[model samples]
Target: MHILALVLVVLPLAASQLIGGPTTVDVNRDDVQQMASFALTQLNTLLGSQNTLVSVVQAKTQVVAGIKYFLTLDIKNGKETQTCTVTVWSRVWLNDKQVTQHACTSRTKRDGLVGATTSVNVTRTVLKMATYAVTTLNGLQGVHNSLDQVISAKTQVVSGTNYFLKIRMSDGSQTQICDVTIWDQPWSYMTQMTHHSCVNAKRRDIGMPGGLFNADINSPDVKNMTNFALGELNRLQGAQNSIIEVISAKTQVVAGMNYFLKIRMSDGSQTQICDVTIWDQPWTHMTQMTHHSCVNAKRRDIGMSGGMLNADVNSPDVKNMANFALGEINGVQNAQNSMVQIISAKTQVVAGMNYILTMRLKEGDKTQICYVKIWSQPWLHRKEMTEHSCSQVTKRAGGLLGGVTNLNVNSGDIKEVAKFAVREINGIQGAQNSLVKVVKAGYQVVGGFTYVLTLSLKDGDKTQLCEVNVWSPAWTMARRLTDHHCTAQTKRQLAAVTDADVNDHFIQMLAHYAVQTINTLDGTHRAYVELISAKTQVVDGTNYFFKIRVRQGTTTQLCDVTFWRQVWMNSMGHVTEHKCATVRRRNVGGVEPAHLSAPLQQAVSFAEDALNGKMNSMFRFVVEKVENISQKASSATTYSFDLHLVSSTCRNNGNSYGKGITDCTPNYGMLQRMTCEVTVEYRPSSSRKYSLAADKCGQIQLV
Candidate 1:
């Protein structure tokens, strides 16, 4: 049966009458013949047999197939044709039995046509699946091309504007859209065509602004898209798989200050855009703000009134406030100077007869300033002046007599002048002779009344003369005479001179009464004389006096003693005074006295008292009294004694034999028995005492 059907369907062409009129068909029309042949070729390929169906033209514009009218082809001539809707139908044959039939219609066309009918062989077709696929691919390519243009334009805009861009796909089933970005240069084609199945199935809406579509080719948006596509291509090149969605970026200014921007993808996910600006000194931003822009949208947010942005900010760490205050204080302290004048002094006497006086000065109550000059003339003279002498003497000497005179006041006061003259006179006198001798003569007014003189005169015409004259005040003259000349000289000669003389003539005379006293005894029952010698010797041809005091017991009976001597060269080669009595007791006792020098009398008195008791105990004596022997040479003396009873009492203390004296016998002993011999010598012609002893005398002593 299938083979009979195939043979009957493969017959040659035949014609049928039209219902309206007889219509001719062009079997070889160029357009009609080509379409018919194409339709038949497709049918044969699909059925795997060349004779799958037979087409018969029953009328001029109608074609019939084995089981159904497959198609009606018409060629019409008109200015404007009616709406023509053409239906296409097909029947399927399996094992020579009809299985099913299908039909499809072409869209109605109302455009004008200018072609005539032609006899054409026709085959019907339900829409071909390969054609639909080809159509879909072509549509995708077209959409991609258009979208690439849009993306390129948007990228250029976005890149120039410092923005980022992305595209996505979505399915409308979920509340949140699932998005897939094409990641190619063009996003619109993927949006419209490649994603059509998802778009159509979900009936999803795509959102992209018309202004974005009109973006400048050179804009940053387009550039961003270009960059996005390039990056995605690089990511997908090896694996060809990657997810695309929202893109994100961040920017910061200061730590807490910055700008943020967000863009939403088609899937309702968001991207962040950030820009950072760091602010230091002299910071500046390149973009300018305009009136139309929001505060954050402005290129530079500085100098605006309403936001948290600040321009020309300053730091609080480096302000200098204290230095200005110190400058003011220093300016006031440089203007004050009145506390600086002398306070007290201490002094010490140094060598060269000068005194060192230190005067302390003060700045205030507590500060001591040293090295100030405070003392005046008199104190200066007492303190610092050296003792000196003027070699030249006054022509007319004799003003105030010898105490201290010739007080030549040059620049100093009375005290200074007096001190100067006293020291001068003393120095001159001391250079000539012993100061003791010069003071002995007392003060003499000489060389007229203009000068005072101190004379040191020797017995042989050697004289040391010091002349002092005061041209001014008398007190100065008196001070010079007393302090330096008479006062010092008297002190030096104090042992030799009497207190009377010292009080009457020397300055500071009260000092003499304190000297130690000397004692003496007289065997002749008369007062003994005291002589005090000077420690120093006189110069050549000079004379010195020994001071004398005659006392009876504790009473000073008389002081009327003079010192006189005969000048003689002694055997010891020294010229000293020879013996003679120069002073005597004024009242006399009844006994006639042997004439002896006062020195000899004093020596005799000393020996008598010292030996009196011992001698009396050793010898027995009657009523005969002791006396000075006479009737001999003036330098020699002899004694005689008469003994009457030869008694044991006359023995010398039971050790020797001697004649005893009766009541009327004279108590004179032999001159040899009463005297012992002694000789004293000294070298260099000085007076010093040496001791002499008697052999077997059992301690004979000399003074």
Candidate 2:
């Protein structure tokens, strides 16, 4: 027989409480089988000899954690037709000691022929073989404990197979105490250590002592015998009953609420049974009673449910349900209940007590047995009922169970809700236009069937769970719940909007507009421009003005634009500057508004002369007010501005000695009275200055 390597090494440590050695103890069936096989091989070899036809007939092994165990073998040995029945008992002590004893009786023929009998005393051989097996176990420990030497080990058997071990080792600073089981006991023990180094003594109470002895509950063979009974139940109930998908099996063990399963049998017939029968305790004889602990209950005591989804223990369903429960149970943080096991399964109904379903199927001379653990009442407190009881029985072989199509509310739809929420929160009008990204979706169980799913949404730097909905299996509709639960919290160590992020976005927009403006200004049809740098100033903590430094083949110009939140609340009614809208506030280096006044014309002429190298002077103009005439797009792109210039000034390069002597100054009153109808074209560009898109500069008319 093949055994896992981990089982070989780990199970022996658990043997301490039973066989006595270390604080850690774990037992496996393979170890017991190995011991039995080894003892039988030695005995078979010793018993074989001349003038004797000795052949091994049958061998069996029994191992219990806290009990002395034995391997029994029946052999037939005789000459000619005469035969003798020989019984062999291979026993092992708790301390890794092995011993074997045999009793033989010869059968004489009715013809009066005497059978030749030999007296055999195999004491020395048995003791030698026992010593050898014990020595082999000792050798195994040497390698097993090579990492951590067991300084001292003390064990105390509680009552039955339950026991505790106290051990001190040189590897750790503290002594380790743990509870273990002997011989595959029914009680559940804490397998994990208390600390990283070793389990503490506090975990010892998790194991219970004086566990009730029910061989069918503890023995794999006896438990498997119920599979036929279960198959018979399925055959009887196969036509009328069908399986239902369970939302949750263990924690929510409500009768008529939790759904059971229907599995297709190899015969193409659906096994429609969801309940188990306890043959040891007749169902009719059962009484409606509750027990504090079902593991300690007897036939006269309380039993678990019958048809509850959680209580249905079909062979395949048992493992599937157990695995599902484990995943959900383990997800709980710092769970007091770590493991689950089904100690008893019966058809009888015990009020408010957990039980296992039992079934038996008879095929001519053979019987197929099945068992299922049912969880009811307060399931969390009854951790023992969470485990599976039908390990020995094989799952019914078939393709798959057929059921009505259940429209599972896909989690993928959460993205849509997130998009909707992002649109709502970010004021996006449609899902396609919304840039809301779903970060994660968390699900919460509601009404034991439906789920309230919350989706975390992200828009640029802002994040929130903007969308929540109720989703359930078999329901086609994903009902919108609420958007109030999700609120944006700034990411850790990240401010609302970084200077770099704002700058980058602004630069990108400016680059796009600048290229377009430059192409229109210079008529070069260029697709790109060299961005010098943006000079920014914050105003009223709400608006940001950018002075874009733009250059096109050594022709550098400065342009100005302001970014601010729109005057109205976003479509979602959220007051946020997540997306900046552009406002053409002024001309280059000028405040107020843009106008085609005398000062503006003089400044324009100065700029033209400066570009032509005809004048060595810096030009300045004051824009009194500017109005955008273009329709607003998703982003600030192109805009038409009506300019009103107030004043203009020019400094003569020859007047260095006189400091700032103006070569040409426009009349302020004259510029103020005129509302310049010159259309100042602006697009997002690298240079802050707007190029003459449709230069009708001198066409300014007085308002």
Candidate 3:
């Protein structure tokens, strides 16, 4: 059965109908319709398909950063047997940027389809959908820029009496993002609608109103002065030059009236300065025009240059007015000056140098405040007077010379700072243990009276330098500076080395691997074996550091000889008490030091079997004591060592059980012994080269 349905796909409904959020009612109807039309056109292209019918099912509207519309459409395509649903979204922003998106899926078809449409009803369906979409979009809000115009129109449309919108610009002090729009009305159509504009809610005025006068500058004398002033102003404006002048004119003031200055020129140019004085200033009486000047004047030792106030008059009225003006200026300065404070500081005390002095002055007081930083020697002279407010004083004065008072105020702990640095380098996502320790701390002369207290920190292979600048005088809290100069102890500049025959080079490379293996064991900063010594074989035999003794019946080889890895003090002979670490474990049955000249035990076993008459195997081997390695090329040098082999034909010099001795009788042991010297080139590189040979002699067979 073919069901016929015609549905319109459109933008979202009014914000009020969707949820309790902002409604952009203040937007102009024309602009809103234009935006909606643009969005609908784009939607058509996105949803266009061959032999497909689409209809709007539902629309949702929301208001957050801007207006957003979510539209649900029912889609049917002749190519597909199943129906699908498409969701289209459109977001309109205040900056005239519009974004629209749509997605279609055959997953689940919503139940709100008006009805199915046959081929004959297809044209009707498309027209109905387009019309509905355009209508709905035309009613949607436009870009917020035209908010003011929409609000004004709305106020005039009903009766030209009621004002419905107020526009307010946002300042940092405002807490909420506000958008004002008119309430949706039934009589207003989308094509002819107006909107409201967001505005800062007016703050209630609690202070009692004072008496003030509304001035008229239309009088003959006033008109002449205003005309001249206007001419000067116009000339300045034409030249695009700034004019800095004191405006002083005689004008009569009437109590309890609004003041206005209106200027009119013959050429139809006009100028007006209305509401020159708010309710804060009151005029007592109307009198003949009198001259009042405050040109670079000083009253009560307060400099009033660049400002005009009635400080010349001794009358109570003039004094009150002057006091009020001074109070306001002081209040503004105080707020700005108190924003910063130096709670701690550091400074250098020079024996004979003279430093500039800093001091704070009282409000409205013009006296210079200065205090020279001095020592026992003769004071140096400075001619300039450095001016500083409360905030600038601490920073400009070098430091609080007296000392710090609060050590904890506004200062980060040095150890904590170092730990944070390490964590960042190691990529730790959360807080972890502080791995650095302060080594040395002292004050250093930086510049003038400013000094930075520096600290040195060491943690395993990491080192960090920290500097703290605390206020002097009462050294309590710091201002402006605290930092850590992190230096990884293990970090080294790569060196170019070509020597591959040095024994130290191979040992160094092996040592580095051992260090890495040790670090990976528990993943904590631990001591590394920074240096390795070569094998020392004495006459008593395998007594060297790299050699191991295999007893008569033991299967142990030279590889079993393990070194206890620990960190040693670079300057001292002893190991580090806390940073020292145990040896790293190997893949074998026992743990061993990673730093080694070679797998000596393995080499020895291979050599013994190869030289023995039983095994028809051959292997070249070497053993040697690592000699001195130059400090400059230690990181990149390859090492070489001489391998010494001592083998002999011998039987187990002990008794064995007659029944269990399958391989050899107690006295007759199947063994061959021989001695030879071979050289092994040990490269710190990934590959090692060795030369080994064994020839059979009459009684001794060497392979």
Which one is best on TM-score? Answer: 2
Q: Is 2 or 3 the stronger prediction by TM-score?
A: 2
The global Cα lDDT (0 to 1) of model 2 is 0.31
Which candidate order results from sorting by TM-score in descending order? 2, 3, 1
Query: Hey, what RMSD does candidate 2 come out at?
Result: 34.8
lDDT of 1 at 476: 24
State the lDDT of candidate 3 residue by residue for 1-703, as single tens digits. Answer: 1232222222234423544342333223554444444545544343332323344344444554555544434445554422322222344443544433333334224533222321211111122222232233324523211110110111211211112322222122321112332322211222221332333333321111111122222222333344444444343234221212112222211121122222222222322221111111122222111111112212321211211121112222222222333333356455322111112221222332222223333333233222222222324432221222223223344334433222231245544433444444333222232444433322322222222333334455544333234222222132223222222222232121111211333333333333333323323222221232333211111111322111111121111222222111111011111123233322212112123334543433333333332322121111212222211233333322222322222221222111111232222122222333322222245454322333332322211
Quantify all predictions' global Cα lDDT against the true fold. Answer: 0.24, 0.31, 0.28
* Model 3 residue 617 CA deviation in Å: 47
* Span of ten consecutive residues with least summed lDDT in model 3: 567-576
Residue-pair clashes per prediction, in order, are 45, 50, 57
Order of candidates by lDDT, top first? 2, 3, 1
The CA lDDT at 350 in model 3 is 33
TM-score of each: 0.14, 0.16, 0.16
What tens digits encode model 1's per-residue C-alpha lDDT throughout 44-156? 33222233222322112332342222223222223212111122222334312221221111222542331222111110011111122223444553431111001111111
User: Which segments of model 1 are wrong by more than 4 Å?
Assistant: 1-482, 486-503, 507-537, 540-544, 550-703
- Candidate 3 lDDT at 473 equals 29
Error of 3 at 338 (Å): 7.4
